[model samples]
Target: MKKVKHGGNIYEIAEKLGIQKEEIIDFSANINPLGVPINFKKALIENIDRIENYPDPEYNGLIQAIAKEHHINREYITVGNGATEVIFSMIASLKPKKSMILAPTFGEYERALMRAGSQVEYFHLKEENDFQVDDDILKTIDESFDLVILCNPNNPTSQMVENKRLIKILKHCEKNHVHLMMDEAFIDFVDEPTKETMLPYIMNYHNLIIVKALTKFYALPGLRIGYGITSNVRLLERVNDHKEPWTINSYAAMAGMVFKDKIYREKSREWITSERKDFFDELKKINKIKVYKPNGNYILFKLLEERKDLREVLLKKKILIRSCSNYKNLDESFYRIAIKDKGLNKLFAKALKEVLYES
Candidate 1:
């Protein structure tokens, strides 16, 4: 399998351009424009001495916080360096013989499946359907597959699997004895996450597993804090036992504090709700591209014009957007951009308009 290219690599772009990293306005990685929360910053500063010792292997406080936030049992929660670790470890433990994933979704699922020696298949999301998961997925998933993966409000595309339709798929997978892994990393940014989340279904279906990250929503990507939730205690134990010790550092363990920052949480909600609307609305005016309505903090668009070198052109202007060419089902014409604060988003819009039309 080939290596998957992820966004947020300002270092490489900076090096190639011989410019400082700070000069680049990145819309490549879908992170919070509000940046790190003030409370978390204070916690990090106060807990700087935490590095002096190893993190509690059990991560009691962290697990408790997460459990409280979701009202799930701590026994069902498993923490990792990031959702990536929990994903790899969970797949490894499951050791599924055959697995299925959505094409043009996050790349790590295939990579992790390959590492576990599972044969991978893709359920291609039709471009004409706005790349949304529909009833067809229920037919695609059956007893033949050992595991099925879904990225709710899927990456790049930023489209969600409707709750009603998702339940139908879940029932089908359950009846077929197929394990379903749902990565809800960006769900927090969506409107009405409570209505859409599958966290409530985990208890009823042992086969259901949810992988989430505090990285994007909490602006703690560098801290590498993520976790998996499932009612399958046995599977959780296996995942914990098979994994390396203390993959989560002391500082990362402090992620539990983020959940308690209600003030910061509300502020973040206000920012994403407002900015996502304004930014997406502005992008819609640019006729050079077809913008997909977004539920996450990022938007995916396709260049209607013939230009395939948009990323390069924008980079010259100190702007960076994710080229979707490397994603399984997407081509060079497709690109994904993070919804940022008003000024930067406007700047990106201007740069993109110039690249698409003026140039």
Candidate 2:
């Protein structure tokens, strides 16, 4: 019911700080620190004149690239302005009377459900369990609920649900005639995406809808391109019918080309593999906080002994971290920090120590 403020807000921070947006070291966003792919940069620059033409409403080229990259049928995919757009559109199309979402998950799910006039319920992920989704969720989802949504490597908490457990839940939902939607937006940042992704099983489960984003893994949030995959052709058709024409722009459509940028993809893989380990270890050494073992490119930490305003202190140092207070099951003491380039990550830890220990 309350307004939600999701992160990646450098502009707002910069305005309040009376400085340029670039002055802020934004750890609030979980985007790849390797930045945009070189291929995308070159393509975008070369195709600057693309703005003169309208994007193909069907997004043929983009869809083809995505299908090829994932080795799935193009018809199984529905591209959107961002993963958020796809989420909102999918919920709108499903038009469920009651929907269940993980508490402290992405705020947009609740917002979208509310907008669609659906009664939304929360599956409160317990902090004691490191905020992971467990068997208790099975009890909460029942025939009355028409839809269930989950976020793998969930935001803010940085917790990934086990694949086997998730599959069990999906089967239960299918038997009960419930739609199951899984947001894998941050899954690519995880150490082993192939082992963790549910995308492979989509064809076998028509009720399963998997939402993915190029924003975090490819570092192209500004371009606003993401997509949803489902095997239910009828549902896909319904979603496409309800969407606004040309919601995806020319550059964004062409941006799909970057999905096949093997060099950029491998570089990101290596960066996250090394940095996530080093950064989590460093944060663990700082006893002022309780750091959750990171499986993704971000870490979730809780203040142990400090009552100081963590966000405010970090803001003063031109560093922005995600305050998890807005999430359903989290509180003021909890925060999420992006695993950035080694230099910036070290600087963040140093600044955090000064705030927690020295001053």
Candidate 3:
């Protein structure tokens, strides 16, 4: 098990740069620019005393919020401290001998799969194809693998797997006796989550599992609440049985209440829907980099010409963007940045141009 570097490392970057954390404009983390929901903030203030009690090991309230939001049975939901916790618990319980993942998708999947002693294989998404998972994925999955994990609107690429193609792959995995796990953590920020999600198929396929996170869209990364949904009763039970009790803190448990806060949710949806297009179009005009069309709340770009270490240059300007060098299939020319407020997006664009032409 080799240790791998993870992104959104503003603290480390700030320490090395000798600057205050607040001074950096972090476009590294794909978090909502709206910041934490106002409803969650008020709840935290009013119930600050919640810190005294241990969070319910059962997490009934959290599960109910998720279930009601998705219009699914409460029994199908399993909450975790964050999506990462659920990911680790599920992979550990399944104990698959062989697992498959996307080469440049979120890194944690490989880490979790490897920790469970599974032989990992990658469906190397091609750069020429703009990193989309194509029909070939169905042909690649077979009986040899016991588990397959995919990140829709995949990280570092921000490219979505079409619903039709995803269903075909799901059917392929199901017939092959391979468990399919879809990480829809960023799905809420996608164009049409209702149409794209695999949640609707869970009831029909016991082999299907969907993981979601409140950390990204809800801007509650600090609160650390995430969950996995599956109709596979046996595997769900195994996940619960192996999970550490109280992994979700009291604040995290209450943070789930904000999910149903319609006002905040709508505002977030409107912001992402309207701003992402303009931002993507603007990035396209920059000659210094090649921007990948985004389907999520982040855009992936590659530097052109001689400026390979652009991330280091931007850090000097107190802007933190994710350098994709550590990702399995990415290198120095690549980086990923969050789609933020219009003003911040402009700030990033200006800073990037300045770094390119003036630095």
Candidate 4:
């Protein structure tokens, strides 16, 4: 398999452009516009000495916070360095004979599934439907496949599967004895995280496994903290066995404190509510591009004017946008960009319009 390329690599872009990484206005990685929460930063600095000792192998404190937040048993949760670790560990432990993933979804799922030596297949999300998951997916799940992966408010596309439909898929998967791995990494950015999340369903569906990232919502991607939830304790145990001990560092172990930052959470909610709409609307004004309605903090668009050089042209303006050419089912005309703060969002809109509309 060729290596999977992800967004947020400023190092290579900077080197290529002969500019500093900090100088790049990144619209690649879909992370919170708000920087790290103040309380967490303070806690990290105050407890910097904690690094002298190893993190608890069980990560009890971290799991306790997660369980408390979602009102589930700590036994239901498993932590990892990031969602990546949780994903890789879960697939390794499951050792499925075959699996399915959404095409043009997160690249990591295919990588993890392939690493586990599973036969992988793609359920391509239709471009005509704006890459939304339709009832057609229900027809795709069957007893033959042991696993199916879903990225809710899916990456790059930024479209969400309706919870009603998700329940149908969940029931269908359960009946077929297939595991449904739901990646809710960007759920925190959605308008209704509680309503959209499949977290509540994990208790009833042993086949359901939900992977989440605190790094994206809390702007601590550098610290790398994420987790998975499932009702099956045996599955959790297997995942634990696969994961290395103390994979979370001292700084990352402090991630449990982020849930208590309710004020920060509210502020982030407000920002996403206001900015996501404004940013999407701003891009839709350009007749040269077709912008999809976004449920998460990122938006995917296609250049309708036959220009494949948008990424490179935007790079010259010291702006970095995610080119979706490498993603399956997407071509060079497609791009994905993060919803940054107002000024930056406006700057990106202007930059994009100037390039696309230029005679």
Estimate every model's Cα lDDT from 0 to 1.
Answer: 0.92, 0.91, 0.90, 0.92
lDDT tens readout by residue for model 3, 28-64: 9999989888877988999989888887889888888
Question: Which runs of model 2 end up more than 4 angstroms from their true locations?
Answer: 1-3
Clashes of 1: 0
User: 2 or 4, which is superior by lDDT?
Assistant: 4
Pairs that collide in candidate 2 are none
Candidate 4: clashing pairs of residues: none
Error of 4 at 126 (Å): 0.8
* Per-residue lDDT of candidate 2, residues 98-152 (tens digit): 9999988889999999999999999988878888899999988899999999999
Against the hidden reference, what TM-scores do the models get?
Answer: 0.99, 0.98, 0.98, 0.98
Clashes of each: 0, 0, 0, 0
lDDT measured at residue 65 in model 2 versus the true structure, 0 to 100: 91
Q: Cα deviation in Å at residue 312, candidate 2?
A: 0.5
Candidate 1 global TM-score = 0.99
Residue 103, candidate 3: Cα error in Å is 1.3
- Candidate 4 runs further than 4 Å off: none
Which scores greater on TM-score, model 3 or model 4?
Answer: 4
